[model samples]
Target: MRRPAHLTQGRYAPPVPRRTLDVTSADGSRLYAEVHGPEGAPTVVLSHGWTCSTAFWAPVVRDLADTHQVVLYDQRGHGRSPAVPPAGHSTRALADDLVAVLEQTLAPGERAVIGGHSMGGMTIMAAAERPELRARAAAALLCSTGSADLASEARVFPLPTPGGRRQAHRRLLGSRAPLGPVSPPAKWALRYATLGAGASAEQIEACARIVHACPPGVRFRWGHVLYELQLTRSVSRLEVPTAVLVGTADRLTPVVHARRLASVLPQCVGLTELPGLGHMTPIEDPDAVAGRLRDLVRDHLATAPAPRGERPARQKKEKTA
Candidate 1:
């Protein structure tokens, strides 16, 4: 794992100590990823949502490391990756970055089971639209994300009215108060506001620290894109089998959105709706998410016929040469 040099001297640092793997972006920008578990096992790539880094997936990573290879990266413009000059920050660009990581770290010709939480899921869906990535994927886990036109599905802070959304975006973009590396107070606010809403005091405090330690610029700029973003169109073209996992209580990406995605996806197999889980399904219920992911992976692997040895069902009676 490699660490980007910019992160060390930047305004924010990750609250928890994280291992780093150096990777390059589609445009050759240096990117860093935190990798866990054995390298030879089946690979599972974990992607985090907006305003978050790889640390958000720590719980799930811990649970899956023993059985699978887990790779987590801070998306470009977040975590340890250097924020480029607005040149490589679009949804498609982020999708390309994900491919770069897979090509560089994972073995050649290997297909991986990819899971993205929230915006992370959207990134993977966008990646799936790419022919190169779609061909290399064993399966896809779309967790807590939805497709095109999300005005009704997600909550846009400050509202998307005529001036409200733009005002909010300007505030977030220009205000060093929010993006100039979070202060402890700001971190606490974020914890209560997002990550640890109903969690224990200890958990809330821990989350606050993590939130506070995030880079301000990353949070500010990325939050704007996520709030105003939608990915439904790109995902409709995805070629691999997909598993849609949604928490029943998710207010951000509601169950209706998940249902729609499942209905439209060509390869949707497991559409598991967990009771009482919320937007941050992995963080809110790591075990449950892990269980469903494991089951989905196993089911796909088990049901899929072997390519070289097994005959197609229609041609089963034919003799082998």
Candidate 2:
């Protein structure tokens, strides 16, 4: 798919990383990771959604990199990350990969406000109970994701009956069909399924470029996992302050999923609903997504108690005086 001219440059293009590395997951999958912003600044790690690479976070990264240490990683089988064995496609692998990134990137006793979109959000939920997550993550932002009922609640398929819709979506998800070049028709279809009605040509093209870049086999592998996703228990186990964001027009995982997440999350902060946006919340409204992340950083990470064995800046100044 030919991207629009604007998308070829500016915020649509992937941000330049200060450092890049490969993080090896517990299952031996190597995840591609990029670090941005000043060293030792408050950190924020972002996990992109299914069929999306770290590039999908360009806008948000641009907004935050000046002040925060922003870390972006490609999920297994997505972006620069190599495809993993079929056994590594489960939610447990997602958790393992997240922990690996946290352990490798963050300084000892440091914590970050983590943000995930779609499948990335599922990654956070899957890792909620992990000691690594608890130690390194102070807060979380879950965007346009569902804990369960993905296929049954998806607005695609247009079938009148729930069972019919679920069955149709399951088949569609499992299909290994190639997504050919991004033509006008393909853009329209993508917009209908993922973005809001007012999505601009640039936004559609940006989404298309990232989504189409995903390998068909990898897409199908993750799609099958999503088809059978059941992570409500995981969501409940998230003990840190967490906020949920979703679009009212979201077709894949609708507003209901956000409401459910808000209700079930152990430390539910709040749910922000954006009218007219679809499943691609971050791309559809980058400002809103960035704003929420900033809020989490300010409220949770910034004011968090300094890690053990580390002295707060103010305390050190007082001692010197």
lDDT of each: 0.65, 0.87
The residue pairs that clash in candidate 2, if any, are 1-182
User: Model 2, range 115-208, lDDT digits (tens) per residue?
Assistant: 9999999999999999889888888999999999898888977788888889989997898999988889988988999999999888999998
List the lowest-lDDT window of 10 residues for candidate 2.
312-321
Candidate 2 CA-lDDT value: 0.87
List, residue by residue over 1-321, the lDDT tens digit for candidate 1: 432322332112222322567898778887788666654555678788876677667677667666566778888877667887765666877788888888876766666678888788888877766766765677788898876545434443437573564564445434445433435666455543344245444444444444555666666666556655677666777767788988776656678879988987878876888776667777767787777667655654333322432233311111111
The Cα error of candidate 1 at residue 297, in Å, is 2.4
Question: Residue 195 of model 1: what lDDT?
Answer: 44
Query: Which stretches of model 1 miss by more than 4 angstroms?
Result: 1-19, 156-176, 179-198, 302-321
lDDT of 1: 0.65
RMSD after CA superposition, every candidate: 7.8, 4.9
Best by lDDT: 2
